[model samples]
Target: MSSDPLPSFPFLNPGEFRSICSSFVNRVTGYSGDLRTLGWTNVKQDYQDGSAMLIISRIIDLPQWANGEQNDEGSCLQDDIEDDDPEMLIRPSSISGTSKVEMEYHILLSPTYQVPVLHFFFKNTLYSGPNALEIVYEHLVPPAYRSDLKQVGVMGGISMTNHPISGIPVYFIHPCNTASALQTVQGKEAPTAETYLPLWLGLIGNCVGLYIPKELFASLRNNSDD
Candidate 1:
């Protein structure tokens, strides 16, 4: 058996994080992009200035009604919308049907929190209407978790900040209470490196619209039983 020890929940050491990230990269390979109808793609591990991270990309379709333009009345909602409120002042644009936008996600271990943090942004440059944060709130944030994610500076909120290494402005789901949040779903059993990421993605990734295929989980189960 390998000598590596399994990582503890709520926190992950650098070595353990790398091991889990590598396993995650492999699991997502050939299972995303054009290979699957609805899944992430461009999965790989990369390093910059000695830090390791996992990167993945996907194209998401937004319904025409997802537009965030203000109505002709020229009124706008207050900037201080309550954290518990998911309702937004959005109006449909002239565009019809659905529109696609390519989104990229960067998963890196946080030095302070000792947990994985997700940084993501869409790839379009010319597209304009609302800022990244506004777009995320309007189209990506699920109504179920909208309130919790609005509580910035606290757990369960989506934070808009600059990338630690790249210095690029990006949006990330807060990792502050990731451990406690994960504990609720992880149960009493210790999680293996192979299993950690899928669990993390299920609990955390969904905040920003990342979802793993159910069939992939079934495939992993079958492989483990062999």
Candidate 2:
């Protein structure tokens, strides 16, 4: 390994982001389970400025409870959600069991925050609307994170905004406080390139229902031992 100093905690330069994306994708591909289960791919846009984004597009069956199939009282989310409270923005929406949901996640380097920002786009088999955010809130976000996400400033909570690269409306976890969150998770010491992306995915990805399988880490350990 090169002795070059690691980038500051929670922040990665563009070059570092590309390098880590490749390493992270390769590590996940080594997973023993079906590769499609993890659904991670490293994609670099061939625009004038080559930019890479870690992409994961997958279809998930909403929980039975959220689908309003089990219980009589269906989800109370509205078709259009206004950002009245950045902290608590989810309202009841009409989503049925037949609605197919395909969620696409993009992890890109944020020039302003110097950290990776997770931008997610939701495509519904029925229709796409503000209710998409409701699906994320009700299905993807954990009960523990739902409350903290309301503290937008402190937690760098979830918000809907235009994607920087695509300029399309999408939901993303705010990256402003990412450095602070990583510090708490990773401790005071800086992590190397090999370790940084994994640590980051654990913190940020978990918020939106993305997870790195334990098998990936097991493979990493086995490789190091060899």
Candidate 3:
């Protein structure tokens, strides 16, 4: 491996980061959910098998919007505070006439890290004249430096709980480390393999995001039953 230190990338503000992270979470989880509903038994396994490659590809593309590195002259930072009429703002046709809205957030990984972790944040609301919010996190795991195989994981947690505006569900996944079995050529610190696995997995599934709907939660429980 090259002796050079890993590359460094820009960091995003909390709101921007959260937005990207949420979207990623929703996409990955939604995909998983769809597969589960379709009775796909090996969805997780197949996902793991390809996650490394997918992550690397994303790293290379490094979309500006995803990382909040756009040149919009700070348009992203500005919020619509003065608008008295929500209708004044252009809304997607899909959400027209419906109070329900969904928003996405992104989290960028450190470029220098051998294994990158990206978080996707999602917000879902149901129309009821009151703003209801649901949050979810999608953790992205890229392959370790110089590794060919993809060793990705997904876990979910709850950030808040209350009413139709229940808290967000956060997901945690592991990235490659130098010292562990999924060692990286560029990593220096070796995360404790024995302890980190379960801890990471549980955190990914339990503490990161809030679970909504007993039915959805029940499905998750059953899926892990085996």
Candidate 4:
């Protein structure tokens, strides 16, 4: 007797894939008044690690602040200074760096499947408390995807506890066929807790298809000032 070859998984077109991603984000954050809202549900019960809780808790405790308020201390600024020499006076002597932090989340979706894979990187100041950001991306496989072993077949690996930069916890929803880098940072050091929180929240929102509230972003900025 001959065995039949495995059936190929249906590939999702760009429009279909975007729709699926949009639906996924809406389903996850639909309950929240704002996308930036953080609650116990956001943290998966089975995946609770203390560090993740701490980061979420701290964000919940921050006060509301606006994005462009003068009180906002994290604003990016450029300065021009002149020297005594004629050419020097015409042109600035040197460039001065300011305080700021940035976090990047990279999502890679393959042609074989619909679900998008996620990776993250963080850049912060040296004086910043912790150099890493704790991030978790969780997804419940749809019934259709679960039924097919060849299609899903352990597409992802187990979550990791520590990522580069900050020894902070890093978690993934599924493993990909090829190993990919998760978090990375190229800067003086990790960002402050306050600045880090907003960036982190934004990254989560992007993965889940939530709309981050401008007010919430402001709050993070305001808290960083203090």
Candidate 5:
């Protein structure tokens, strides 16, 4: 981790971080890239305020443990979606994980701050409550981030919510102002790939029962041109 700010985000811009995720998802799923750059910044999530949010997101394949019948394909949203749009980008349907095991990742950035938020949605499953989240927080995340989830609107912290949409519940995990959580190997205080990516993959992957070694992220670090 460098003394410089946000060693985690190579370009210090959310867009670049978005591309990094795009590349990572691509490598893991082997699917045609469907990453979407959201149009609005004020997109609402539980326990969050409307702010300058630059978000890049996508819905990808789920872990096998997220067992359930895959939902039927959504009706064509061509009329509602933008041209060249890989997926629907309008209405609540703009997000694809309805009544199924949808793995959605959102990389969020704010103009007023440098550290970004790591947010994801685990939708349409039985794991939709504070109890489930407690199991994850206590077992998966490090002690430093164990308390982060309780701070919903804090600048550099984390939060969790089990909110339902149209009676369909989803589990949401949000890590805000992530720079504050990055502690280096040498006992330095900095946010770098050495720290951020492992923590992100660990907590999120554990909830889905996926194993993601930090070494697997080498592709993302090398593919900066994306």
Candidate 6:
């Protein structure tokens, strides 16, 4: 979260959804890397928890505003003194900090939900399982996607829940609009693929402040026609 260049989100079709996922990774604002495929329907990517997926940008020189925000500096100093790691020089005069927090994200196909489930995990990062979920709620997942109304037996909202397959805690966001859009493929009278899936994904991207180009509409249109 303290990274200089922060990140953003978005996606989908049946076969067309695959193409949308590809575009999202390559066309995202401030990022232009290819995501590696993990399975037939899963795309995997990593982002620096504090930077651009690898490096951590530390606040070498503390700012005045930060002083007020981190008013517990005295306690932090005491803790630092207790640790006494010489490599971590934490003093009033100078503080050289390093953080290499990395996180991996997955857009997984959910056969049950009939949509893609947004899931992510952090390694060597400050956020724990629940903390990561909160970050996704506050920074990544949109409010509308969350619902207090239980669909089956569970609650809604971005949840830090366990992935059914891996049994690991992760930040998860549900794709609420995927069902109706996918229905179009079955010859159902629902929103066209071009009209919904890419737009929904683009909204996800925009929520994360990613620049999903308007040209995406053109592509979505092309796919829907087929």
Clash count, one per candidate:
0, 7, 34, 8, 0, 8
| Model 1 per-residue lDDT tens digits across residues 1-226 | 1123354665788888888888777666634344346555577899888888988788877554534332334332222122222343233356657666667889999988888999886654222222436668777877876777887523367766777777755678878888877777887765777778888888888777876667766665454444
Candidate 4: pairs in clash: 25-208, 65-218, 65-219, 132-166, 155-175, 156-174, 156-175, 157-175
**Where does model 5 exceed 4 Å of error?**
1-11, 26-104, 129-132, 135-158, 161-177, 183-211, 214-226
Between candidates 3 and 4, the one scoring higher on lDDT is 4
Question: What TM-score, computed on C-alpha atoms, does each candidate reach?
Answer: 0.77, 0.74, 0.22, 0.26, 0.39, 0.40
Q: Give the range of the ten consecutive residues with the poorest summed lDDT in model 4.
A: 75-84
Best by lDDT, which number? Answer: 1
Question: For residues 86-174, what per-residue lDDT tens digits would candidate 6 score against the true structure?
Answer: 53332233334433333455555555664566555543332343423444444433454434312411222355667545556565555
lDDT of 3 at 144: 27
Report every candidate's CA lDDT. 0.67, 0.65, 0.26, 0.30, 0.37, 0.38
Cα error of candidate 1 at position 189, Å: 1.5
Q: Lowest summed-lDDT stretch of 10 residues in model 5?
A: 38-47
Candidates by lDDT, descending order = 1, 2, 6, 5, 4, 3
Runs of candidate 4 exceeding 4 Å displacement = 1-11, 32-104, 112-115, 123-226
Q: Which residue pairs in model 5 clash with each other?
A: none
Q: TM-score of predicted model 2?
A: 0.74
Instruction: Rate residue 120 of model 2 by lDDT.
Output: 83
Ranking by TM-score: 1, 2, 6, 5, 4, 3
- Model 2 lDDT at residue 94: 52
Give me the displacement of residue 110 in model 6, in angstroms.
0.6
lDDT of 5: 0.37
Candidate 2, superposed: residue stretches over 4 Å from native: 1-5, 38-48, 63-100, 124-127, 224-226
Quality of model 2 by C-alpha lDDT: 0.65
Candidate 2 C-alpha lDDT tens digits along 1-226: 4224365656778888777777666666556667455543322322224777878666666633243322233322221123233323333355444533566788888899989899886543222245456667777888878888867744578877876777666789999888898888888777766677778878888888876657666775575345
